[model samples]
Target: MTDHLPRIVVGYDGSASAGAALDWAAEWAELQADEPHEVRAVIVGTAMDPVLGGYRARNDDLLERWRSEAEQRLAGTDTAPGQARERVEVRHGPVVPELLRAAEQAAMLVVGSDGHGLATGTLTGSVSQHVARHAGCPVVVVRPRRSTVANRIVVGIDESPEAGRALRFACRRAQRTGESVIAVHGCFSVLAHVLTFDGAESELAARSLAAGERLVQEVCAARAPDFPDVEIEPEAIPVRPGQVLVDASRAASLVVVGSRGRDAFAELLLGSVSQHVLHHAHCPVAIVR
Candidate 1:
């Protein structure tokens, strides 16, 4: 039964942020105690020597050390009794590829961000960024938080399929954690600029707001039956989608967004709004594909 259940994989490297991610993942698994999941941690090692012209085998002592540390961390995480530290895998290869492979069939992949401020900013070449963009499953990039009192799951809502999936994911999480959901839709439309010359700016803005509200309502209504007990609050704000989500993240436990929005580039792996939120959101951000 455990093998058949979905896996929740955590990328651990013994950093503070990684330890936080492991704790978060373990607690998330505990939330699903009614239907247990397979929770595991992975540590990726290059173990390569350019001068040797071949991959060097990992020393047994070093492998055991990593495994031992990961297991200890998992055991120490706050989780329900009888929760086993199932697997602590140490794989050798490129970091991103190894982590992706470890979570190929996972329900969700949890990773840590450096929690850097605007001055330092999130690096484009970081492992979490690459994994969030390329992973087949939903990827959550967690940052160390000062508090978790804010229990709202803020999600960006739109008519796109990916956005709908993101909303569903957020609703499911809210259902499990007893958190509320905030469905936000930006009402800034390109047509507002053209209508300004004709003195129809106010009218356009009202229409845009109404349309945005309808979109959010319809989307939330569709999922209402599935999440009967989940609380959802819809908002149609006249602001940029990224900015709205970033502001909401300040008081949110988690901010969820689709990998690609309706107007995103077809060739891009990650959407601009998601990238912006991932870089700027105050809380953990989950990129659903």
Candidate 2:
């Protein structure tokens, strides 16, 4: 539901990642002692369609079972249980749409990575990605395989407002975990660059990419210079920003993305690609406004 403080909404479909997200969200929800927080466990149903391989998981009994399990999981892992304030929402609808809908009321959403999996294996699915693209708020894609505490915070920077927001948010998280922040700006050739590689345009593109990386580094250092206890390592990846961000997440605890607001972003704003990484990333993605 809506509140003055941010809430954590997680999409659950009996997947392990969802369970992990619930655990992580519960812990985070308790962090804001003064502010009210909520955690929702939503299950989205899919319509029968040939294109989607006609795969449909519709069982009221199963749904109830999952709900009980989620509650038990939350109860088990959540500390200071009696005093914490939050809600566990269980709704039925299209998974992605339901998540987006739940996101409408949440200041931030936390989801498990790879919600598509089996009894014991890596969960790699697209639900998180879908929500990241269309959610009304920032999304956090959690990696159940990793520890609840963050190892490192990774932010994709392009000197855009969204990216700046992501970096600042990431730094805050780093401060909480006493972890380092690796701000990465992925660079690569655009479609135009490929078309005009041999022309003068190629030179311009090279210069522009270089400048962008330098700017990302400069901004990261300026915005998050001294962590004292938490180390901040700003890095520049000379490849596609999304790819590099995804790669960075392989070893990171959290990945940050832009919320992709409707209004035009400022000079320091990040693009949709940052949003893209939120969905497909291997670790938790924190979207900053």
Candidate 3:
């Protein structure tokens, strides 16, 4: 099998959100690969110490139970689903670390918000946040698993090369699925993020808007001219790019953002706009490097 045949790895802790994510990943795996795609569902064992409860052997027992339940969950998801190869792994490590390790070999990592373990925030689930920040691969966060909504696909674009790569990925996926692409380039004055540049807010906003428009044009020019005739809309919303993208993601089928690269200011390798959208977007979010 080709190393890049597009496998989908999902995190599972038996939460509703995690189940939804697994279903989405299975569906995605079947759709993205012609050959049997790998759909590995990994369970991050509970952190609670069974030994403390006087059941020292219970740790392994609990993990075994989790694996069986996970397999059942996978079987339950097989409602006329595609023919992707399925795997269930039970590990006793931190959720995020395990997921990230799995992501190293997979094409994409799929996760859920508010899983068996989580608090709140965009990518509200701990696994979502950790993968978004640390994983070298892209992560798709699926939220509100029960909703049968066909939302649009949103991609955040800036002048960075990674952003361009992210836009292209989002557009291609949208075309295949007949989903709308909202290529949003969030723009605001540098003053918005920096206090020293306060006085030049108006001029900075103007510059940001202008740059955003130019970015849209550049995207069209650089990307395949006839790639599905994606409708390009240049946006100059005055807010942090991450915040703007998150807000725009409410009804999107997928939100795409660049990985926060070495350029901490823009290039997203992890824990950037893509991460936020992954959690906040009502649908799924893809992080591109």
TM-scores, all candidates, are 0.86, 0.73, 0.79
Candidates' lDDT values, in order?
0.79, 0.66, 0.68
Per-residue lDDT of model 3, residues 1-289, tens digit only? 4243556788876677777888888776545544556778877664545447656476577667767876886776642234545578776555666677877867778887775442222223765767766778777777762235854777787767888888788877766576777777777656644643646555556776787777766775677475746655556566777788777766666778887622575534445566566556666677787
RMSD of each: 4.5, 6.6, 4.8
**After superposing candidate 1, which stretches have Cα over 4 Å from the reference?**
50-65, 78-84, 115-125, 190-201, 266-271
Compared with the true structure, what per-residue lDDT tens digits does model 2 show for residues 162-238? 77777778776667656788887776656546756444566656776777668777877678555555666666655
- After superposing all C-alphas onto the true structure, candidate 2 shows an RMSD in angstroms of 6.6
**What's model 3's lDDT at 1?**
47
Clashes per candidate, residues 3 or more apart or on different chains: 0, 13, 11
lDDT of 1 by residue, 76-98 (tens): 76655555546788776677787
Q: What is the lDDT of residue 29 in candidate 1?
A: 84
lDDT value for model 2: 0.66
Worst 10 residues of 2 by lDDT: 116-125
The prediction achieving the highest TM-score against the true structure is 1
| Candidate 2 Cα deviation (angstroms), residue 163 | 0.3
